[model samples]
Target: MKATLILVGTELLSGGMIDTNSLYMAEELNKYGIEIGSKITVKDKIEDIINAITYGKENSDLIIMSGGLGPTIDDITKEAIAKYLNKKLVVDQDELNELKEKFRERNLKFIEINTKEVEKPEGSVTFKNGAGMAPAVYIDGIVCFPGVPIELYDMFPKFLKWYSEEKKLKSDEILIKDLITYGIAESLLDNKISDIFTEEGIDYEFLVKDFGIIIRLQSKISNKNIVEKIVEKIYNRVGDNIFGEDSDRLEKLIIKSLKEKGKTLSVAESCTGGLLSDSFVNVSGASEVFMEGIVTYSNDAKIKRLGVKKETLEKFGAVSEETAREMVLGLKTDVGISVTGIAGPLGGTKEKPVGLVYMGIRNGNEVEVEKKVFKGSRRKVRERAVLHSLFCLNKMLKRK
Candidate 1:
């Protein structure tokens, strides 16, 4: 099966809001072996919506649209869809009554404008939105969803189930595996594993993302044995640089490893602020292994909070390896990590340029500090610093 995605919103074009719905939709559809042929973003105007739908219908078997489903006047997705399909709009009384009951349950007044939320194209199938006011409607091979990300996420599973049954889709045709790797350049990674792409019935692509490089291997035949052989070859070539597989996060893996090994960790941050700590805490069950974290943004905080000596800051500055080592050593845990960097468009000197980072990892009596220089904006530098810290920590954890 093939699909086309339409994202309709003036805010998306004007940079007022990001369009995240399409990515989620594409990934979910791909799980069912539905190929996304194209994705179009258009303004909230009816003409643009109709044109996009026309293109979708011409090129793909399924058309999925999101946005402009609110009660406001500018919300015209359903109107354009009805116009394109030559259908009349009608109010679904059951949906309207349910929406009103929901509003009343929350002790909120039901405004007259909200009635527009239940108006679907005549003879179309409608699915109630469990997370929001608008209902998703399917008409003439197109599915309409509210632009709000949470609502689309909540309602996508129901749509997917209905769609698979209606189309009698077999999901075992295409299979994809994603290998996430860090601490290696894309060109170097390609040099190591590029030869394996010549195997029959398999396709490959490399994606350069902010965090790392993703090696996506797809098999058209869905032969598990061939896919596993190719994966084994790639692993043999790439080795430890391949940190995790599909949907595996480095922070979450670190937390899980710590729990398995019966270890606790703490962190101190400088230019990275609290981002490193935030990543660890975002994982569930982190409390079992995460002991404490402190953001010593100032020299005084480093000296007072983490017990760094005044002399060390004066001699080597706060962004030096000496300061990072002291910061990690001061923390009382089975493992301690520290990051200090100069992430800047300013506050850079000849000796300490922007993106110069020092990361320290201390496990037991052993400690190591690494100096790295990265390139990008301030946020990029800070994010890279955090990723580097996690990579180094992972290496330490693998040690005997």
Candidate 2:
């Protein structure tokens, strides 16, 4: 089955709010083998909402609309859906009584405008809202949800249960696996696994995340063995670039690797502040391998805290390979990583433009420092530097 998602909110259209509801709905629908045909975001205008509904009705088997269900006059989702379906908007007396009882329970008086929450399109199946006042509406393959995330979350399961039973959908499960890869570009990874993507009965989706590229393989085929073989083929083709899969994060993997090798890690960070160390500490059980982390933002701090020499900072500057190496060597640990960079919209010299980063990783006596010039905003530069440091640490641990 195919579905269309419509997000209705002036705030979403005006960039004041993010539409996370669509992401949740898409994931849930995909789990039931329902393919998303289109996703539309429209402002709170009545005409636009009706047009979106009409478009979705023509193109999809199921249309799910979220947002604009409230007591306010601007919340016109129910009215617009009623107009589109050519149905009367009538007050559901039972739902109205429920709303009044809920307000009474909270020691608040229910106003006349609160009746909007109980109004539904004529002949629609109304699901009681356990989380909020507005009832969820479903009619003629269209499901309407309130804009509130908590209410939607509480009501979605009931809708899903109804949908499964009404449609008599087959029990064949949709299996999805995310193969997380780093240190590789999307185009290169796609080219390497082009053959596996073309194999029958499987679908592939490549998503670029902050850490790296996530190659998602989804199959509805009943046989699980075939899917495993396909995943194994991709793994063999990609090799070490594929670090972990599904919810396996890079920091978690790094911490796990360090623990397995019985090694300790310390960091001396400059331009990235304590971001590299923060990533390491984000993983649970990080205290088992993480030793210490210090952020020496200024030359004085570098000298006082990490023991970076004045001569190295003067000659090679703070954003240089020599400074990074000195910082790493200053930290006393089995594994030492240092990052010094010029992440800035300002304060960049002609010789050292913005995003000039030097990362140093030392395991035992062998130390490797890499000089890279990335191009992006200050936050992007810092984020990229942190990932690069973690990737370098992963390589060092693998070598041991």
Candidate 3:
């Protein structure tokens, strides 16, 4: 079943707060065979909440609304839901008793605002909040949750389990192995694998990174034993370009390579800034193999910090194969990765249009440099550069 997520908060709309809740919810829901159809952030207005909730109910089978379940005047999620369901704001005696017990456990008295939290919409099911005082409400198709992420995270699973069972969805997926290939365009890859996906009644997802692509095959099936047979058939067709299977990020594979080789890594980033470092560090055990990361954005920093040659910068500009090679050569560490690129909505000349990237990797005495023109926005260019850098490093690591 498809679900809609609505995040309500004036803080989120005004950029006073970051909405991390929706991102986490979307990924988790996808794993449970529930697709996230729509996600939006609305203000704390009661009318806005009611309108959003009503609209979600009509289009989506399940609506997961976050924020605005507090006792403050701005906390209008509960009231808006009550108004939409045409139900009264009746005080829940069981919830009131629980509130009193909680306050007593804390050696405190129950206040009026806290009493307001006990007022859930009539005929609504309350998912008890183990973490906080505010309870989440589930009335028919709609599940309105507390704005606090900690409380919402704890309550979310309980509701999902209940809803998934009611909807009779099996949490099983067909697995297929992908053959990874480099130096192949997406259009070409699709032309090759499109027939296989259709013949097997399977779903395919591709993640393009650095200089390689990861193709994933998934199918929803009743029998678990059929996964091996289907995977073998796909491998027979496109086994040359496949890397690893089942959503393995390139950074993760790079980390595994470093661990296997017993080697350390350092990075010198120019146009990509610290984005590449951030990606590597996001891995759980990065500290084990990743030694250092430098964001030498300016030529002066590149010369002073990474010891890039002045003559190379002058001869080959900041974004050049010479400069990228020098950035690696200047590295004090044994193994290094370098990315020099122009990620631009601006600052690109006719000769050097936007999205020109040079990624280089040093795996011993041998160093390899890849020069490519990526096409995308500034964020996409940076992301693509990082992916390519990791891919190059992964290949070099394998040769070692």
Candidate 4:
């Protein structure tokens, strides 16, 4: 099967907002052996939307649209689709009542503009939105979802299941595995396991993502023995770099390790701000293992908060191994991690250039410090520094 994604929003064209719903839909549909023929992003104009729909229908078997399904006046996506399909727009009474009740529960006034969320093209199948007031619709091989990510995420799966069953679409019996690795270059990783994918029905690909390298192995025959042998060989070649498998996040793994060992963690940040702590708190149940996080961006704050000595900051200039060690040692937790770096387009010296970082990890009486010089923009440097800090913490946890 083939499909085209129609993403409608003026913000997307103007670079005010990014379109992530199309990427999510594409990935989900690919799992069922569906090919995406094209992705079209149009503005909030009715003429542009109709043109996109006309183009999508000509090139693909199905059209999936997202955006312009809101209470605002610019939301004319349904009207355009109705005009293209020659159908009248009618409001579903049940959905309208439910939407009103939702507003009442929140003690907000329900206005007439909100009625647009319940309106759909004639003879279309409507699906309830669990995350918001909007209802998704399907008519004449075209599906429409709300622009919000959470609403689309909640409704797309249900719609896919119903549509798949209604059309008797069978999923491909494909076996896939993802081995995630960090702290290694992609070229070197490919070189290490280049010769392992010679067997029939076994395919492999490498994706260099922001987190790390993903070695994806797929088997068309669904043969367990062949897949296992290939995986074992790859592991033997570069096992030390592999951290987790499919859908495994670094922060989640670190939290799991701390819980398993009955240990607590604390973080002291400099260049990364609160991003290092924010990553941990984003995971569920992290409160059990996370004690506190302190951001000491200035030298005075470092001296007062993490107890870094004034003399140490003056000597090492805040982004050095000595300052990092002192920061981690002052945390007083079962496990302490500290990050100090110059993630900058400015404030770089001849001795300490931009993207130069020092990470310190303290486990009981032992303390280890690492110095690294990364390359990238300011945001990229900060993000990479956070990941490296977690990697160092994971290694320290493994030792004990």
User: What is the lDDT of every predicted structure here?
Assistant: 0.90, 0.89, 0.81, 0.90
Model 3: lDDT to the true structure: 0.81
TM-score of 3: 0.74
- Clashing residue pairs in candidate 2 (N, C-alpha, C atoms within 3 angstroms): none
* TM-score, one value per model: 0.96, 0.81, 0.74, 0.92
lDDT of 3 by residue, 1-400 (tens): 7788999999998979998798678656766778778887889998888788877887888899999887789888888888888889988787899988888988987888888776878898888889888788888788888878888889988887887787776655433444456656878878876665554555677756553676755556553346566567666766645555655667888888888888788999998889889988999999998998999999999899988889989988999999899898877666788999899989899888899999879987889999988899998899888877877787777777
Q: How high is the lDDT of residue 305 in model 3?
A: 91
Clash count, one per candidate: 0, 0, 10, 0
Mind giving the per-residue lDDT tens digits that candidate 2 earns over 331-372? 998988999989998878899989999999999898999888
RMSD (CA, angstroms), candidate 1: 1.6
Instruction: Point out the worst 10-residue segment of candidate 4 by lDDT.
Output: 167-176
**Model 2, CA-based lDDT:** 0.89
Which of the two candidates, 3 or 4, achieves a greater TM-score against the reference? 4
Root-mean-square deviation of each candidate, in angstroms? 1.6, 3.9, 5.1, 2.3
lDDT string for model 1 (1-400, tens) is 7899999999999999988788788778877888899999999899999999999999999999999888899999999999999999899788999999989988989999988888888999988798988989998799999999999998988998888888888666678899999998999999999988887777799988766799998876557788888899989999789888998888988898888889899999999999999989999989999998999999999999999999999999999999999999989999989999999979888999999999999877889998999899999999999998898888888893
What is the Å distance of residue 200 in model 4 from its true position?
A: 5.0
Best-first order by lDDT: 1, 4, 2, 3
- Candidate 1, position 8, lDDT: 91
TM-score of structure candidate 4: 0.92
TM-score of 2: 0.81
Best by TM-score: 1
